[model samples]
Target chain A: MSTSQDFPTRKSSWKRFDVTVLYVFDLLGTFAFAVSGAIAAVRKKMDLYGILVLATVTAVGGGTIRDVLVGRVPPFIFRDITYFFVSITAGLLVFFFHKYVERRFKLLLIMDAIGLGTFTVIGISVGLKFDIGYFGAVFLGVMTATAGGMMRDVLQGEVPLVLQREIYASACIAGGLIFVCLDILNIVPDINVFISAAAVIAIRMISITKNWNLPKPKI
Target chain B: MSTSQDFPTRKSSWKRFDVTVLYVFDLLGTFAFAVSGAIAAVRKKMDLYGILVLATVTAVGGGTIRDVLVGRVPPFIFRDITYFFVSITAGLLVFFFHKYVERRFKLLLIMDAIGLGTFTVIGISVGLKFDIGYFGAVFLGVMTATAGGMMRDVLQGEVPLVLQREIYASACIAGGLIFVCLDILNIVPDINVFISAAAVIAIRMISITKNWNLPKPKI
Candidate 1:
């Protein structure tokens, strides 16, 4: 529920650093997500166009939905063509070098965790800009972190992994809750973003390493 | 691309009729789509909450996406809670009377066709209200008509029927094209809506009866 007026009036170098770091992480996440999507498409034996489409959707789908919900027209990717190009580059790289990429699956998972964390914070920040309440902001944050992969799974003809069994969305939700609490405490915005994102990354990485899972219902 | 200026200045009774008919059909489509979604969820052995969620998503997902694409805030369903009620009603009915409903599958198909046509024209009309080009308008039209079903299928862990083997989206595309052409001819808005929607319904009905399908790629 914090607004722009809640923050300190003075601008600081830390703010600039926060912006740069967020932007870098966003792009990194986009690339990692796109590569994962492209690899899935390749496994499905999709054509080049299908691979690109899946890559782009996986990389930017969640943010696009987030933007639209906030009444931002043209979405972020449409405004910044860089995301599109980055997804395309990732798709192409995976298409040509998928064997090497698959061999480095652990690296991909690490990058994905980073992406998830960054996207969660980004979505929360964007949602806070609007009049949507804290719950909506947190929901958008989890959605931004997981919706792209959910979509990628759906497109590949499977139930979304987050829905089936994963600690993935839980990490985003936990991070989002932390972000809201920090903001309510009037923590510095730059510090808040970094801390919240790091929390998400840490949780996701630990879950992955431990092979933690959400309990499944008996049929 | 036709704007408000291109339409006749006279506010005829036909205009009122058009508005009423369009609104009614829109609700009809929402209800039918929701029922379809609920049935799918039931088949998947999902619980009541899952059925409701699927029903609401299938009913409103397409229009929500369309509204977002056109920069409309809160989406049409949020602004008019009638759609939400309609979807919920449909879901509950399906949950209770699925056996009877399944027996009338032909009737469901007919209702679905009506929904597809109504949604297509509505989406195009909304798009034209904005500055997006004709192509974008038509694209939105198809997305509005089909995206819900696509999402429903994806959530059920299946490739979308439209992408796989149906002649569904093609019918919407054809209807959208017809709407644009008729609009360009400066036809009366009321007549244009009717003709375009009828065209979609007719194409869909014929395709169903004739067992028409889009070509599938050989793996």
Candidate 2:
């Protein structure tokens, strides 16, 4: 392992994205996921505490798992208070205005896609930092992008959405592959992150609009 | 943090139990949990692959989460080939003998309780080694005892049994407290672990036999 002095050199090409910028994207993704969780909670008519727990878990659960798998102790969510507040705020907003938000399902889907894209980029970057192999990195990326909503669906007594025929996790995997390829080719750091995230978002949007799905196994 | 020469002192006193003993109990617990998961998959009428997947996850899921929280990467199940084989064997057994097992639900419940007890002990010991505080240790213990079953229930599209009226998690918590207190009082390590695990098993058995339940929340 290299010392802090060698940290910059050791970091991948995606490292150039400023921490502040990454933090902002993280919060945006968190908020979007939290709202998705809150909407599910409302549909179940869960109490306030249940809604908040679901929202918080949906926002940070995947990242927590990612951090743990990469041997990062005391996950980022514990270190930063902002993530907690953002998730709670999103939950509160949805709780108070769920009927209005419910009518704007397309808007929610768009926000979720944005969250998925950004989270995939973040997961890839973090996984690369841990120096896990490309396959492990891509697996982590897909896990980060999909685990939260999958958890939410499971908690609500349904098969995970990711496990069903959907382009959701596939989009994240696509973004991860793009990021890994770009980094390997020594692309500019900011461009690598942007292109990867954009790819995920674009794919998600296109799939939703086109009603795209992976072929299902016929029993 | 210590050198290999100081490894023994760094290890908890509970480490006196040889790897063989620990491995045996771990495999036993894994088998029990795997059978439980297979039963759930059978109820859902999932395919053979789904049944195996559910069984594998249910056998190792709680321990995986516990390991992650303590910054132990590449969980114990991955290191031990026996755990994997035990779980798969159990799942296959259930797949073939599900009707017989279903008719003997009491036996299945007993096996599950044994798994729960042993897992709680393992979680507490690992958490303490990580120096996470007694509260966190107990929480980990309860989580380790319950989370796999909870995940299985959720994956099968049901409210988690732990979340409903059952003395399941409470027994684990109680056992954790006992272990912590005994350790603080300088009790012999092996005895402490035995007592703690036995307490959990006893409590769980009594609860089942007595029809004990925690009061449900008023909806």
Candidate 3:
């Protein structure tokens, strides 16, 4: 636990292209998070209010926690009404058509991937926004991608997988690094977001499918 | 719907007291909260990490949210170590002795009442700390008493009750008023905390047992 005095070093990067990519990825990641939230609520036999809370947390929980961590005031939820509106609409749709959607939707898997990837990139972007170095970006990226789930679990009275499952947040960390690399190469920001998101989603899917996991810390 | 201007009016409470009893009630309230969190985990078949998260959130979620609302940075989890230790110990005890405890423990019922009551008082205390005024104090009080449960639900992917379930929160509002009245009379702060806590606990128990509840809002 090094204090702020020993801020981690980051590679010199961040051309204009990187920023543009981040913006695109951010939206995709948010939408994916919303989908995941909706699915969780639908599975839980929750009423409308429950669905709404789940959707809101899935979409914004990550950033809300991140904002608090970075000393940003009130976080992004209060910044715009669009975010909330999007989550609510998503929740309503999930509530009304959950059974049919769950059976038919292949998009959920894609959304999960995109969400993992995009959120990782967004977290790194937040790190850059606050002038944090590379390591900070990686840390924030993981936090951003997983904090929503952590919060979602807390709200649902479950333990967050982030603390127990090794690979859960590792995907985001990997994607964040890719984002840093893309920026250094002066790639378009939107492209950077896509690439980073892809990396996380793929890695996560592969890890899960292959039963890859980190060793648990011994007591 | 009310904007920033409403915030000042909301917080305009002037009930004065020594502000010490608040501490005693707050401690008892925290303990009760811890019990609730741990019990929920037991009910849900959550793993150890789940138990830890639940215990922590139940103990501190209300206060943390209140602090955030008042623009107090880092909240109580960061402010002191006592809460962390207490929550963990409570969680471990619940996990290890849940079966024996479940048979013998009327503790949950009593603890829940105390938790609700203490939380109601604490909420107003936070409002007063911020000098948010009368309406604000009660509003905050309700939020404080219930936000942890809301968080608890969200984590389990359940819908939060705070946005609905008028009766539970309204009791807190009433409790805030009771505390404010005592404050205006310049009651001893410790006594004020106890009285206010008592009012909330008693109200919760009576209301729940007798099926007392606020009128449902027309959707």
Candidate 4:
């Protein structure tokens, strides 16, 4: 139920541009994540309510966990109703348009990577604000990027991509390390976040293109 | 690292008795849940670190989630560290003595029920303190009782048992409603907690004995 006026298109400062770009990525990622979760519920033959619940959790679960761990309770998603609306809307769209959406799985994957990158940056920034140390910041970033999808997959009775055969969490970790290094070099916070997000996105895209994966442990 | 003298046995008021009993149940549940988690990790052939992580999460995930939702972050587990130690100890014990532990699944189930009841009471009490209202209290109670097991199941690559079978969350809800009813009838807080916890335990035990379960969707 957002009005067109809610779009802040006129703010064109370098800092403001970075904020808008990240916000757009966040929204896109949330929407894609919700769609994937909804699709998952559909496959599981869950009811409408289940679809909504899955979608909402997949969209916000990672950030919620990150916030909770860092003691930022009554999480940001609770304060900002838009995330809820976005998730619900995405679920509904998927429910009504499954055939069309199902074919776009590849596109959804790309969007999920973008969301991962953006969430990683956001989580690390929050961790830095709490002064939880460099390692803690990176851990939080990885949590924010992957925990939601992990929960979604678990709820759907599947191994999480990050835990199985994917470079998802590693991308977040790499991005987080870059963010820390940039901060140490006195980079502006906004620009640091932008570069980190870009790094995550690039790494994720390359991994997908190359079919990169973490080595499975020998049992 | 607990001393036997840390167990208070001198105070014998009804409230004191309730506290001690619940404390015992809490520890029992934590230990049992950790063992169950360790067992699951073992079944999955998780590494030692994975076993410890799974055990710790299964013991504390539910309560941590409840605390976070109720704005009680920097969760008690983080502050106490005992929960961490308890989970780790349980995991190590299971790793070393799994064959002996494997045959004790029945005992573990009984302890899990007790832990569920205790955690449910603790969550509702915290919710009440936050003025989250009757419904919020009940919701938190259920979350605290079930979220750990759900996380454990998810991490083990399965759909959460609470969402699928038995009277697990339903029992929590029933007990929470009883807690509120008792509050309305002016029952003492400690007594309310004790009675509510007993109700949850009873319901869970009966459900298992009778093979009771919520209806699955026909679709």
Candidate 5:
């Protein structure tokens, strides 16, 4: 079968596959966030330009903030431009077919959960590439997962759900911590990514199904 | 009087004086923004930590974003740390004596006007150092003047005043455009700064006194 001779080529191909998967997940996450943002803008009765602005910001805002903090100039979206197009496409789709999209609320939540997990891992990976410590990496992860939603709420003149009583950011934090711990233990990078992302997705899904929430201050 | 020989020395000393005055104005602006943020946080019944966070963000957020966009790593505040101390001091004072500060609201508004003008000119100067062009410079100028207040308002779960009917951002835009025009005419840098800042302060003050507002959408 020539298994020994093909080992190096197979390993390289596997690496490429892993990268491709991460990239796909990142785009999916952007689309989901953009859709949510467009929905919010529509609910606010904002004009078409406003809807597009909100969607683009909600999709790329967190990552942009993360990149700026980690000293990445111009941000990744500025360079690639695909994220901008994806967000615009999502916004337009929702603007035209909002009722249909709203009918699939359950599906949207699932997609959002997937996005949160993927974004957290991506943020942590980026942070770890810098001199920021593990704590900073985890912070970047949680910020990447939640900041976009916060920006959306803030733009709409509402307190952020994450700051109020959502289990959303907590799930991201847990997943980020797990990723860091596994990385510290010298786990395989690919396996570590899968396990951490899965953990976040699981936590988020369970919380949604169980109607879980973080405790609110009794002011 | 040896006027010819003294001309070069006077010019150099005048340059130093201009820089020092700008630095002082920057600090004053930071202090003013921090006090405003602290006031907002108190109104929202946020805790001490929340007050501190809001104050710091209000004072530095615009400058930090500007630095990041211009590819400055770690940001100027991180390196100097003076801005941090200035914000903390302002926050602490407001937390303790907010009633007194509130009573002197007119003085606060004047200080804020000065800050708006200074920040706008500073942002434009920074942007001009990059390859982002004249329009980008003006945009950065307006952004630097208004973004901190926007952040403050957003954190308090309110629509940003700059984005509302306020004439605040318009004043900044005018000041920025004036700065660009004067620079293009080869006006002296010091005189350009003074004229641009005066234009902003005048526009803001006149608007306040006349209770001016931008027209609202009739939707």
Candidate 6:
């Protein structure tokens, strides 16, 4: 569906584009992530500000953790205001549309898969930018895509799904390899982003649909 | 008051006059911090394992953040398993005694103040051990004391009380200064710890009691 079709009649529909769709995917990911955070907040019966805090962490905590681990100073969300804007916007939407959003949790999960793929690729890109080893890049991608959710779960008092679930982090690792392979093929950078992201999203969605999982330890 | 009177009885609660209380105090702070985290987790309606995550973050997050900022490798909590052991024990207590604990919200705040004081000093000490300067030391100190709570609040979807209240952070700063002053005075290190910890605990307790506040921004 076209971006315009997604919004139906909203004026901001003009912001829609194929390239921006990548960003929209990211934004949708941010929104769903923030909603998960918001749902945790609601469970906590937090005030509006508290909800926003949870929303912000759910939106950015993984990236922030990844940055700190890579020894980046002050992390991007702290350095650039754009991330803050995205988080706040997402948080407000969650605050207003929580009921409707919760009813569509399954659809949001699919959108989350897309966002996860995009982030996994971004993580690999960042690792390469930092001259990290391939192993390090894979680790960074896995951490970047999932740590925020882990952090959100931890803060909300849940065991991180990534810790126990065999497929969640493994898929990010798979996508990171796809990114590495594409990079080795000398693909155009923009197409690389699209291909890697689509790969991750596909892998994740298929795995979930088919109940495909990495072998679990019998213990 | 005897350690038994004000704090929970841990293994071998009494011995070694000077350092024992401080270690116990650290444990006390850890317990209170972990409890607060667990309460927030419960508020979020998380499962059993989730409570442990919240508890651990609440207990160690502030110090871990401070360590990263100061370029410390391997956060102190992870380097020593003592913290995890203590945190989990505290979490179990919270899980079991949540009802009774909730009734003593005000008392818990007092314990939290003591925690703020002790952990701030501990963070500063950790920074100085790395040969960090006074500015960096104090900064880490405050971060060590408050960041975990902030993370807890953010994850639970609440505006961090630390940011909202002046005394919350101010107490850590004041305690950091006290640690510095005693260090400069060439006072015995053990005496310094006692005095500095007392200074923070007293100040925080007073601030909360009086509802002390920083002036609001004129803008």
Q: Name the candidate that leads on lDDT.
A: 1
lDDT of 6 at B93: 78
Q: In candidate 4 chain B, where is summed lDDT lowest over 10 consecutive residues?
A: B1-10
Q: Rank the candidates by lDDT, best first.
A: 1, 4, 5, 2, 6, 3
What TM-score quantifies how close candidate 3 is to the native fold? 0.57
Tens digit of per-residue lDDT, candidate 2, span A1-219: 111111223345455444445556667778889998888776766655557657877888888788777877756664555777888899888877777767888887887888898888777777777889888888988888888888888777777878888799999999898988988898755667678888999999999889999998789
Write the residue-wise lDDT of candidate 1 on B67-143 in tens digits: 77676775665455677778889988877788887788988888889999988887887777786889998998899
On TM-score, the stronger of 1 and 3 is 1
Model 4 per-residue lDDT tens digits across residues A61-143: 88888877776655666456678789989988777777788899789889988898888888887777788998998998888
Q: Alpha carbon lDDT of residue A168, candidate 3? A: 65
Per-model DockQ against the true two-chain complex:
0.17, 0.16, 0.12, 0.18, 0.16, 0.06
Instruction: Work out how many backbone clashes candidate 5 has.
Output: 0
Q: If scored against the real structure, what TM-score would every candidate get?
A: 0.61, 0.59, 0.57, 0.60, 0.59, 0.55
Candidate 3 Cα misplacement greater than 4 A, ranges: A1-28, A46-49, A150-171, A186-191, A198-219, B1-14, B17-59, B65-71, B74-143, B147-219
Candidate 6 clashes: the total is 7
Better of 1 and 2 by lDDT: 1
Fraction of reference contacts reproduced per prediction? 0.28, 0.27, 0.13, 0.30, 0.28, 0.05
Across residues A28-85, which tens digit of lDDT does each residue of candidate 1 receive? 8999999989999999999999899999999999988787777876678767788899
Q: Which stretches of candidate 1 lie over 4 Å from their true place?
A: A1-13, B1-56, B76-150, B158-219
lDDT (Cα, 0-100) at A196 in candidate 5: 88
lDDT (tens digit, per residue) of candidate 4 on B83-153: 78889999998889888988887888898888888888887877777666776577677778777887888
Q: What tens digits encode model 5's per-residue C-alpha lDDT throughout B1-219?
A: 000111112244377777677777778888898999999999999988889989988888888877777786667777777889988998899889989988889988988888898888888777666546676677677767777887898888886656545568789888988998998998876778778988998999999999887543222
Worst window of 10 by summed lDDT in candidate 5 chain B? B1-10
Q: List clashing residue pairs in candidate 1.
A: none
lDDT pick, better of 3 and 5: 5
Q: Cα RMSD for candidate 4?
A: 7.7
